[model samples]
Target: MIGARLREWARRHSDKGRYTPVGIIFHWVMAALVILQLALGWYTTRMYAGGDRLTAYQWHSDLGLLILFLAFLRFAWRMMVPGPINDADKGGWQTNIAYATHVVFYLCFFGLPITGWMMWSALGDGRPLYVAGLVPWPQMPFGGLDPQWQWAILDWAEDLHQMFILILIILIPLHVGAALKHHWWDRDDVLEGMLPDVKDADDHREGLTHKPKRPRSPRVTGAG
Candidate 1:
């Protein structure tokens, strides 16, 4: 009975304009992970000397897999809990662009890792992929393909992976800029909707109304 009530409470909260706690947590966590993954990838490409270079690649692979798993969970959560609604008053083109950007973001979340996995499999180097040097991860089926085809596919996957990464590099800034523009220029609840502690516009207005006002100063009438 208590469990059912708790779930009901959670559902009600998640339906509000602002993001639910779970959603907020997932958003920030994924943002940090993606940034880290980008850094690792960039560094690994530049460094080509020692065992440390190999270690960097391993870390990048493990992190990419972890991100893919989290992306799946985030997608499931999004399906279960509808995100905050957009400003109904906004222009149609703006809204459509926002939605399209989100679709691309989701695609990158899934595509990048899958391409990376395919590239790894096509290498067919016979080395096990260990997650953080702990558990062995199975390679994709392409590892069994003939050498020429595997290398060709590997080149293709690498190109796709790089393309997706570049797309993310461009999109992330635009996404952030749009949110900030909404919050600062438009003075709307768009950005706050994703934040956990900040109140939405309606709640903020409500808070202002309920807040106790300071007593007014007495006016002097002696001159009159």
Candidate 2:
């Protein structure tokens, strides 16, 4: 019953060509965390090996775990309440590609944190782990393993972590470009759906020379 109520609540917003507030919060919060993590990761790479570097790394790991936790919640939310169908949902190869891109993003959302956890565990430094420096987290069961195997795990996790990061580096630009194109060049509500308390250009001109008229009916009508 709760799930049904939640879905109905989400559907009301989705029908208006917007994401539910819960979904929007999850999206932007995770997005902010991800950008912060990327910047922190870059900063840590340049810092000399010392206490400060270790502190940075500790914070990074804490954030990664926080991301992992939020990702789980977000994924569950997604499963319970599907995303809105905006202009970008037009059925075509482009739409298919967009769907694939989302799948990869969810993979990265899960992959980065898991691999980072593995790497930290493999290091066997015996440092305590936490989620956002609050929730106590356990390391992977690597402490009992032999040194050679621990090294192997460390090497494997490091490679995977870098691979995920590289993939994100490539995808983020394209994603931003696509959103901007939908918003500006195409003059669509695709970007507005993810934005909070923001209506499409047609609803509020903001600063445009002339106000665009809103459509009375759905533009595309198929089960989203």
Candidate 3:
């Protein structure tokens, strides 16, 4: 019964070419965090080996774990509530490619973090890992292996992490460009669907257009 109600609520918003508020929040919050994570990762790699570098790495890891957790929740929510069928959803090769891009994005979202976690675990330095510096996160069971095996796992995970990072670096701009195309060239609500509902002056003016204007008051000529 509860599931049906939730579906109905989400459907109402989707039918109007908009995502539910929850969906919008998830999309934007994750986007900001992912962008920050990318920048931080790049900056951290350039830092010299020292205490600061270690601290930067910890921040990077924490952000990764948070992103991983949020991605899981976002995926579950997406499964439960279908996205809106905007103008962008029209049948074509572009639409197909867009869907494929989203699949790749989700893969990166999960893949990058898991590989990073593995890399941390394989280091075998007994350093603690935490998710967003709050919840304690467990490492993969890599301590039982031989030193050579641990090194092998570390190298493997690092390679996978780099691969996922490269993929994301390439995809981010393309995704933004596509969204801009949908919004500007296509003049559709596809991009707007994910944006927050804000009543700006333009929207207020547009709303007034549909309402009856008040009659002007009769002017008195006695003063003249």
Candidate 4:
């Protein structure tokens, strides 16, 4: 009986096309972290210098690593349980564009932190990264280059890191705008699907004590 009830519950949820609870949690957590990291990155670069700059860099590095770890976990979860089916009524071009956008986001999520790590490693300044000023974080292996090449490699990595940041700066706003467009303009559940702790009217109706009435079938008439 328990197994049958669980199967029925799964069927009902799958039919509604909503994301699984794990997916919703991961999505929102990562979204908040990414936003925080971006704000920290922009503020630290613009406001701090000298020792203050180094301290800010430590925070930025710590947050970047955290994001990197979460990004991998989120990717794994996504692979384990696929997202909802795409809207069949939407045009092929729009669907393809959405897929491409997601691909770019995943690439950035992985790429930005890695380049930042490389930049720090290439510097070889011997300053340790302490997570929340507690545990010492491990440095990447690129720290031991010859003095002649160290600065050159640091410069390259720094450039790449900044480039990825710039890409994110552009892409994130566009992504948010598109989600808002779906929610407000198109009046769809695209945005709500990824959020937690809120259910749509249909979901509420599904949970009601009374059964819903079924619509009547139209009477068929033979053509003369």
Candidate 5:
């Protein structure tokens, strides 16, 4: 009795697709960009402590600004259009982890840039960070204060920024693994929603002249 009611509810709302897998490709692409930033950030830190001297701090500053810009774009994108629910429709631990990890990801990615902005704004190495020598972005200005304490605070912020990136890198594999598992093990196209140029189910249905099968696919899959 309860199962039948759940089925009816799903049928009614299934036609209306969610925000995920829209025309935007930022979901996957930005994620890849973040991972790349993490590696560069780590290398930057090592060089900051007199590792390479000339080239050490240079890349770090540039990447930090890039991180700031990317975070702004990513955060805006997320708010503009929340991603669709799991493609597999298994809104259990998988859903919970995916959501939680993403929130943490945002925090780490955004925190680094804002802190970096503060760092550069205060103690710039005599020059500014720029993109393509085309535009000069202003850094946040903190009024006159003790130089010693300010440097200490900036150091800590950068440390935490690196720590969070490390945490996120570890979680990414698990997150991606789950998405693929849905297609490989569960045989679901939940992953297809965000994949480029996928054939929407509704479109596939339009071409079909015959009625649907008893089960949605080869077998009954998905927990909810």
Candidate 6:
């Protein structure tokens, strides 16, 4: 009786919070940008040092600006919303890892782009990075840091950005694998909570609400 009542309460207050397309857009768009940036980073680092490409520097400057704008909005949105927490997760180790990785991911996404902006601003060229005659971008290692010191700092920022992302790639799979484990093995709703496509079409169609006989604590156990 006690357990059942607890569950009903849990259902009443489940963190199945609705998400804005901002969240949706931020998540995927950042993913796309990061992948593109990785490729661009490689191309520019080589091309700048002398490889072959028409205006590699120009492209890098422009893209860095794009990253800066997107990341700024993403972070602001994250602050406004209390994100959904999946119920299926239930372990300290896993939970901790997820939290840490997410924090790091945000840092990398923001830090890299911002630094690039600083670099460009510091150059004092005042020329905006653009492509095909549209879309303006800012630079990083922004002017005023002094050439000798600025060069070293830029190198550090570049190296740090790459290292964090490499770790990020590893974390991505661990996160997905854990969610899937809960779905198939535990037969839980962790995966259901995140599906843009309804995995629980039945429950959804039944009116998006379940009146559990009992309620559980609003406590969440895993990554959201």
Give the alpha-carbon lDDT of every model.
0.79, 0.89, 0.88, 0.73, 0.61, 0.62
Best-fitting candidate, scored by TM-score: 2
Residue 52 in candidate 3 has what lDDT? 100
TM-score of each: 0.81, 0.89, 0.88, 0.79, 0.68, 0.66
- Per-residue lDDT tens digits for candidate 6, residues 96-195, read 7767777877887777766665555555666666522367543543466677777776677667666766776787778778778766666555555544
Q: How many residue pairs clash in each candidate?
A: 0, 0, 0, 0, 2, 28
C-alpha positional error of residue 121 in candidate 6 after TM-score superposition, expressed in Å: 5.0
lDDT of 5 by residue, 65-171 (tens): 66667667768656654455446446777678877887977787777667666666667444566632335776555435577866876787667766766787788
Select the stronger candidate by TM-score from 1 and 3. 3
Stretches > 4 Å off in candidate 1: 1-11, 88-91, 131-135, 198-224
Question: Compared with the true structure, what per-residue lDDT tens digits does model 2 show for residues 1-224?
Answer: 98889898999889877889999999899888998999999899899999999999999999999999999999999998989988999999889988998899999999999999999999998899999999999999999999999999999999999999999999988888999988777887888788875445565544332335354555676767
The lDDT-based order of candidates, best leading, equals 2, 3, 1, 4, 6, 5
List the candidate numbers ranked by TM-score, top first: 2, 3, 1, 4, 5, 6
State how far residue 93 of model 4 sits from its true place (Å).
Answer: 1.7
Tens digits of per-residue lDDT for model 1 on 82-105? 666645236698888888988898
Off by over 4 Å in 4: 1-14, 86-89, 130-135, 197-204, 207-224
Instruction: Give the per-residue lDDT of model 4 (tens digit) for 118-217.
Output: 7787788877765445667777765667876888877888888788878888888888888887766666657756655354455456444222334446
- Which residue pairs in candidate 1 have backbone atoms (N, alpha carbon, C) closer than 3 angstroms, thus clashing? none
Model 6 / residue 112 / CA error / Å: 1.4
lDDT by residue (tens digit), candidate 3, 57-163:
99999999999999999999999999998887898999998899899999988999999999999999868899999999997899889999999999999999999
